[model samples]
Target: MRTNQSSQEEVEKTLQSITGIERASPNPFFLTRVEARLAARRSAPGVTTPWAFRPVWVAASLGLALMLNVSAVMYAREALTQDDQEQETVSLSAEWGFDATVMDW
Candidate 1:
C-alpha cells in the first residue's frame, strides 16, 4: 500500500515536470531566396564540362576497356595454343626384345 502511494506521487511529479510549447516561428523570405538561387544557377551555362555532364561517356569507357581486355585474353590464348602445336613430337613402335621401329607417317 505504501509503495503504491509513493509510485503514484513520483508519477504525478514526473508528469508535472514535462512542458509543451504550442507556438513556433517561421523562416522569413526562405522561399524567395531559394527561388533566386535556383534562377541564378539555371542562368549560368559555362559551369560544367560537356562529357562530365553526361552518363553515357562513363558507360562507353567501361565498354571499351572490357572489349580491349577480352581481345588481349583471346590473343594470348591463341598464341599459347599455336606455340604448343608448333612443338612437334615423334612416336616409335617396339618389336620383340630391344629393337624399335621409328614410324613417321
Candidate 2:
C-alpha cells in the first residue's frame, strides 16, 4: 500500500510539470516586426530641414521685437506728455505757419 501511494504522488507531480506546455504566446512575431522597422529607419536617408538654424528668421524676429518695444515706449511717453500738458497753454508761433492763441487751464 505504501509503494502504491508513492507512485500516485509521482504521477501527480509529473502531470503538474507539463501543464500549459502546449499554449501559444499571443503575437509571438511582434519582435520581428519591431526589428524590421528599426532596421529600415537606420538604413533610410537622413532628412534635411530647410529652415532649421536660419539666420534670417532669427534676425527678423529680433528686429520685430525691438521695433514693438520701441513703439510701445514711445506711445506711453506721448500719452504721459499729453496728460502733463493739460494745465499749460501751448502757443504755436508764426514761424511754423500756425495759429498761437489757446489757453486750456
Candidate 3:
C-alpha cells in the first residue's frame, strides 16, 4: 500500500506539469503573407475585354462602311448613260432568251 501511494503521487505530479505551459504564438510573417495574398486577389483582373469592341474601333468601322456605301451610290448613279443602259438591257435579254412582251405572266 505504501508503494502504491508513492506511484499515485508521481502520476499526479506528471499530469500537473501541463498547467505551466504558456499560450502558443504564430509565426511573425504568416498573417502578413495571408493579407498580401488577399489584397492581390482583390486587385487582380476578373474580366478582360477585346480591342475590337472599343469606341474608336466601332467609329472607324462605321466610317468605312459609310464610305463604301457612298462610293457605290456614286458609281451606280454616274457610270451608266441612258442609251448604254437600254443597250445593256437589250443585250442581256437577248442572251438570256427573255422577251420584253410575253404571252404568259
Candidate 4:
C-alpha cells in the first residue's frame, strides 16, 4: 500500500513536469529540398555489371550445381551400400567359421 502511494505521487510529478511543452516548427523549404534530392536520385542512371547478373546465367549455374550435388549424393550412397555389403559378408563368414578370402561371389 505504501509503495502504491509513492508510485501514484511519482506519476503525478511526471505529469506536472511536461506542463510547459511547446510544439515543434519545421523550416519553410525543408520539404522542397527533400523533394528535389529525391527527384535527382530518381533521374540518375544506375550502373550494372555485364556478365554475372543475367537471369538465364544465374538459373543455368544453379541448375548445374544442383545436378552435380545430386550426382555426388548418389555416388556416396552407392559407395556406402557397397561398404555395408562387404561388412555383412565378412560378418557372415566369421559367424560360419569360413575364410572371408575364399568366399565365392
Candidate 5:
C-alpha cells in the first residue's frame, strides 16, 4: 500500500508538471510582411495577361467556336444531301437500265 501511494503521488506530480501551457507568439514584423505581400499581390497584374482573361476575348473565342461548329454542321449536312441524291440517281439508273449519257450516243 505504501508503494502504491508513492507511485500515485509520482503520477500526480508528473501530470501537474505537464499541465502548464506556454503562450505562442509570431516573429516580429510577421504580420506586417504578410500584409505587405497581400497588398503587393492586390496591386500586381494577374498571372494571366489582361487580354486572355478579358470578357471580350472570352466572348469572341466562344463566338468563333460556335461559328466553326455551325459551319461544320452545315458542310456535313450538304455533303450528306449530295450523297443521298447521288445514291438515288444511281438506283434509278440501275432499275431502268437507262443512262443519261446514252441519249448523247
Candidate 6:
C-alpha cells in the first residue's frame, strides 16, 4: 500500500510539472516563405523531373531505345542465320565425303 501511494504521488508530480509547459510553434512567416518558394518553382521553366515523367524527352528516349533494340535483334538474327548456314554446309560436305586435302589446283 505504501509503495502504491508513493508511485501515485510521483505520477502526480510529473503531471503537475508538465502542466505549465508551453507548446512549441514555428516562425510566423515560415509557412508563407515555403508556399512562395513552391509557387516560384512551379512557375519556373526548364525544370526537368525524372526521365519517366518528362513529356517530349521521355517519348524521344523511348523511341530511340526501341529502334536500337530492334536493330540489335535484327543483327543478332542475321548472325545466327549465317552461322546456321555455315554449319549446314559443313555437315553436307562431310556427309558427301568431300575431302578438302584432296583438292589440288
lDDT per residue for candidate 1 within 1-105, as digits (tens), equals 999999999999888776554566668988889999999899997777798447888888888999999999999999998876544221222223322334444
Best-performing candidate as measured by TM-score: 5
- The most accurate candidate by lDDT is 4
* Clash count, candidate 1: 0
* Minimal lDDT window, size 10, model 2: 86-95
- TM-scores vs. true structure, each candidate: 0.42, 0.37, 0.36, 0.52, 0.52, 0.46
Q: Candidate 4: which pairs clash?
A: none
| TM accuracy, model 3 | 0.36
**Candidate 3 lDDT by residue in tens digits, 1-105:** 999999999999988997898999989999999999999878976545678888999999999999999999888776677668878888887898988456365
Root-mean-square deviation (CA) per prediction: 8.4, 11.1, 13.9, 10.6, 8.6, 8.0
lDDT of 6 at 82: 100
lDDT (10s digit) by residue, model 4, range 31-64: 9999999998888757455577788899999999
Better of 3 and 4 by TM-score: 4
Q: State the lDDT of candidate 2 residue by residue for 1-105, as single tens digits.
A: 999999999999999999958987769889999999999888875654457357898888899999999999999999989966743423324455544564344
Q: In candidate 5, what are the lDDT values of residues 1-105, reduced to their tens digit?
A: 999999999999999988896778999999999999999988886666777779999999999999999999999999999999988988888898978346655
Backbone clash tally for model 3?
0
| Candidate with more favorable, higher lDDT: 1 or 2 | 2
Kindly report which residue stretches of model 5 are placed more than 4 angstroms away from their true locations once superposed. Answer: 1-43, 47-49, 100-105
State the C-alpha lDDT per candidate.
0.75, 0.78, 0.86, 0.91, 0.90, 0.89
Supply candidate 4's per-residue lDDT for 84.
Answer: 100
- Candidate order by decreasing TM-score: 5, 4, 6, 1, 2, 3
Q: Over 4 Å off in model 2, which ranges? A: 1-52, 88-105
